[model samples]
Target: MGSTMFIELHAFSAGSHIRGTHIEASLIGLKRHALTNRYKMQTSINCARNSDKSYHEQHKVANLILPYPIEREEFCLCVFTTKHHISQHPQRGDRRSVLNDSQPDKNHKHRHLYFDEATITVSGGQGGDGEAWQTSKTKTVKNFKYKWGTNSQKFIELPAAEPADGGRGGNVYIRVDRACDSLLHIHKRKFWRAKKGYHGSSAPHSTPGRERPRLALTQEDLYISVPAGTVVRRKRSGELIADLTSHGMAILVAEGGAGGIAARPSQQMYSRRQKKEKEVSDVGLEISPRVTTSGEPGEVVTLQLLMRVVADIGIVGLPNAGKSSILKAITRATPDIASYPFTTLMPNLGVIHCERIVSEKLIDIDHETCALPVIADLPGLIKGAHKGRGLGRAFLRHLRRTRAMLIVVDASGQDPVSDYTTIREELRLYNPEYILRPHILALNKIDFEWAALRVQEIKAEVQSLEESAVGPAPIAVLPVSAVSGSGMDILISELMEAMRLCDEELSIVRGSAMDSRDKSDSI
Candidate 1:
């Protein structure tokens, strides 16, 4: 009967029939099969249900369904067994694949941005304390007594000794190191202090009185490392402390205090007793030594560290003015190059070696000499830069240290003349003395079709401004193509010459000042 029922159920499930007669026959066969294996079927159904629930909880299955008993028990058993096997034996490669899928692409990149300014508090170490001590001696005689009675000698107290000197406080020093690239190190540290000196020890045999040994006299100095081209100034007074332009340069920021002096010796002294005594006596004494003074405290000061790029020539221009392109063409610096504006957020430095041949007529010996000048490609400046516009006064300070400036203008841009004037006015407004520095006007992108006309108009406008005394006279105007390397040689030569002339003029002024000072000193 069971065999017949199983065959009938299989036939019903195999064929797709939704008729009432087929349904009734399948239900009857399912009831007969359950009765034949009542205990086994109940256990299998419970196990399947538990497996399904466990699988859903562990694997997070979105939607799951169990087949009807009459349809096919084998299908339901296979599905649940497969899920259980997977749960027990997960593949190693599957986990790795999942992790890889969750991570971002390896080609993704990031940049580390650094600040140029920071404020920090620095202090020197405090001095050590002084100590004091004293010594004492006692003597007794066992000689014959007088007619009156026997007596004993009293305890004698010795004079107190001077205390040792205290140790000197430590000093704080700021040093410039080339290994540091930015002010990031000092920015993280808000306060710095030096180690204090050790205290002095008291002398032996000294009484516990108002005297003690002076503190140990030694000074400890703290050295702070900073990047080259850092300018340190007082935070409160705004006083300029030092300008560290070269590597290994250092300055004393805070000075340690002097050590305390030892205590003076006591005036009173006790001598041995000469008279003899027949009676015996006991003498006991105690003395307390005290420290004279403690060392003075070191200086505490707040300082501001400002970093500026050290370069001989600074390139200034508007966005997309080909400044970075020219820097790349002239030197080996690799600045970010893109058609978009503000591509360069930080300053890039490059070295330009200018070679010159001296003729015998001009100089006694003819030789080729090279002047290696550092060039800085600064961030682009926009209108109202002085008023804190795009990349505003943050970068303007970099120009202050430059000996010469190169104003790169986009000849292809509309109204190149206006661009030049705007940049000049912004510089003048930011610092009136900046206008006095020698500068070269570089009309870039001369390969453009209308660039020639724009160059001509810019030159005319510059001339008119000079005639009207609107600004200082520029060194010269040179047309150059950063893309094609056109007029680059002329631009370099002019920059070198301008730097040379400025140096000569500076030397002459320094010489005159020294001569006047000597004459006045002699008088």
Candidate 2:
């Protein structure tokens, strides 16, 4: 093989001094080689260029060489440039020019994607003013001396003016609609004001100013659509104003001011002698009556809106414990599924509809379907969730509004009892009263071989733990297979019964309050 020579070149700056130093070294090496070698020697030149020191200080660029060799056998030359420092080349000094040449500009703008809470001010319209007017008759004598036997009496007409009444103010309202999934639409807005009523007229010959029209009733009220589980409250007091749990729910947050009272004609009657005396004392001009009144202003209020997910039942469990699988099996919700932890990052909701069948032997009755109950699939919880571990506190709040809960546990895991205990302890630590809510324990993945024995052990452990408790009754445990669809019907039936019982209890309490009110009124 012919002898090959390797050369490495490094350039610190593009100044002439640096270039001259490298050139002198190359010349000396060539002179030394010419004295020893008799065969024709091929020469190769390599150049490396770098930017100024100020540009290099900001970004450090490593030396890079082209992979392909320059021409073979013949005199060859190669040039390499620092990729990172190329943007700051002296020839292209404009910073904007570098950006334009780097990449294609995409017209992109940020959008308000989601908003869950907001504080806003709402003011009702101001009322219009009222006006009124009156007419009077006066008699005047032109000459003091009598013409013949009787003095001549002349009648003059006088008119009095009053201000007109103002119009009624408009009210502010908040209506809930199902179309809005987030509060993003209201995020940009900070204040809402209703239209003010027209002012009353003031004229000497005009009739009582026409009553200002009711603007709030005639025109549309401010409608604010929000998700189904929005709660409105007074910002200052934090008092609950309305809970919008259904579609088309509406509430009047601020009432409009009443229109000012209309100006009425003065009813004081003056006798002929009294009028003559008053006319003589005060010039011939009549005094104008002030009967007009101003309209009242509408109410101003600051309110805060908070959104929470509404559901009849909340499904919670550890990661990969088959909570999402259960929700998918029961309802049409499709949550991402994989054999990994933290697969679910947000909550998913589904609705369940079922009919209540009546037995023919007991009585002849039509099948009555119950209201569809919503189910929320929440993110998995870990130990120390109450202390904000693994986003536990966020997931726990989703259960606060749920009427009931369904706890899912992995029966095929290493220790089913420990997993169940960990979840229970976390919930109790977050909120002591949450444990009192009606709940069902669902041991999932019974299809696995190891699940059968573990289920029995978990049931025994739960029974022992319940016996040592002093609170509500023990929660029912049911073995289920989300994959095989086994024991699903029983689970649904039990959940329906629990919700029905809760509804009955609420109705009884409401009835008692109404009865007490009636008795007090009678007394």
Candidate 3:
């Protein structure tokens, strides 16, 4: 709430809640509806789905969320634009231009889409200034030394108190929208600012008023709400940018200024008098999102979602490495049965229910453990991924969150050595720490008759590498084919053992770190 005072009755997720307080009306006036109005803004993607043809033509507006009145469980944002939406433009030919090309291209003009620069500005409201008033009154009394008392005249000066500083401006925030319907709200407002501070009192003789500044001088407080999961980052280039990612989060975009002190009231200072003043200050808000302009048609802004799906195990392999088929076979995950590569852009999770008693044990352990070991089928990594090639870095980040990795190599082994090396290098580059985690190699496609020879070749290559290597020896490679489900039992057993090792090592490391911290604290 802003400077305006009022009782608020709000109903949250299961029940209604009410709060009664006197707030500045000005602060209330500053509040805006938290909803995004959909306007046809150029998108970020240049190509159309399944169409090579480009369009300079305009399209209907899609709805977006509006940013305002931020609070917990909600997200708010501010955006700046160099050009407004063109709602009244006439129809165009096959090749239409967003710009007014009749004249030389204005700064706002682009080929098929209007080019606009937008930024988000954020600021917190100033603090409320404290109020001061006279505490004692003056009385008149005249008295003579020897004679009776006529009455003594006593004067008391009470200094007026400065209004409380306006509440500091609300902090700027970005939230991930797990439940939010849209991000359009973020694009609605150009600036986010908190309530302003109230003014300090100028006189000391003022009457006792409300705790809030009766006069002017202090600002009210404000808040910006964002949905859960929004990544907040600073536009400024520095380490400050590093604070953005980690889960639903926010950052202090701007802080309100302190309130100014009030002046002493002009009153009789003879008898008991009030002393002290109030102070207030102002704060500014600036928030902006970086946008790239183009001469092509409107862009399609794609929010690529990266999620971790929990499972008993992850099926991972190179493109056409039978990972998709195995995921379909072992679990209910129905990934596309495609002949080409990169069919799955996102990771999918599935549960494997085994009928055997051993399977029961595995299921029980996985379900009960909050930190269950997931059998993830990580996306394929191409050579040179360690240096950020293909979908390298993104895929690697996805796997990093996983407890352990299951390397599914081709058992047909055209170059199992090279395949193994490439995968290992990428993993190391992504996180050298991951090297310590327990891992297993599954030689897939063993159903093929040549698989045995391939396995032998792989073993020889690994042995030679280990002999020449300076690091710990390589992990064991087991052959199995998803087509026939051959050797699946042995493969599963190996996985269970490897996962146990990972858990053991993890516990020791964590325990040691905790001990060190405790010692430091003790000292």
- The candidate that achieves the highest TM-score relative to the unseen native structure: 1
| lDDT of candidate 2 over 1-523, digit per residue (tens) | 2222223322212221112213334334433533443322443223343344443233332222222222223222222222111222223222211211222111111121134566777878777655443322222325545456565534323333333345566678787777776665664445666766555542223433433321212323566667877889999999999988888888888766655434444332123224434755666644333444456688888999877778889998999999999999878889888889877766788875333222212222223545757899887899899998885676687787998888899999888777877777787888877777888889999998889767778888876776224235445789999999887877776777677777887899999999999999999
| TM-score, predicted candidate 2 vs. hidden true structure | 0.56
After superposition on all C-alphas, the RMSD of every candidate to the true structure, in Å, is 24.1, 22.9, 16.9
Residues 400-422, candidate 3: write the lDDT tens digits: 55555567777785777777666
Q: lDDT: which is higher, 1 or 2?
A: 1
Q: Write the per-residue lDDT of candidate 1 for residues 1-523, one digit (tens) a residue.
A: 1112123222112212211112234434344555653233553221122234554344323221112323334321111111111110112111111111222211112121345777888888877655533321222334344334435334334543444556777899999987776676664345677777555453233444653332364666899999789999999999999999999899999877655444434332110001111111233322222334566687899999999988889999999999999999877888898898889877888886333213212222222443567899988999888887888988888898898899999999888878888888888889877778889999999988799667777887776786233367789999899999888878877877787878888999999999999999999
Q: Model 1 residue 340 lDDT? A: 88
lDDT of each: 0.64, 0.61, 0.44
Off by over 4 Å in 2: 1-116, 126-166, 180-184, 198-219, 245-248, 256-297, 336-346, 353-369, 467-475, 503-523
Report the lDDT of model 1 for residue 449: 77
Which of 1 and 2 is ahead in TM-score?
Answer: 1
Sort by TM-score, best first.
1, 2, 3
Candidate 3 — which residues are off by over 4 angstroms? 1-168, 175-235, 240-317, 324-337, 346-359, 363-370, 374-378, 429-431, 456-464, 467-476, 483-496, 514-523
Q: Which is the winner by lDDT between candidate 1 and candidate 3? A: 1
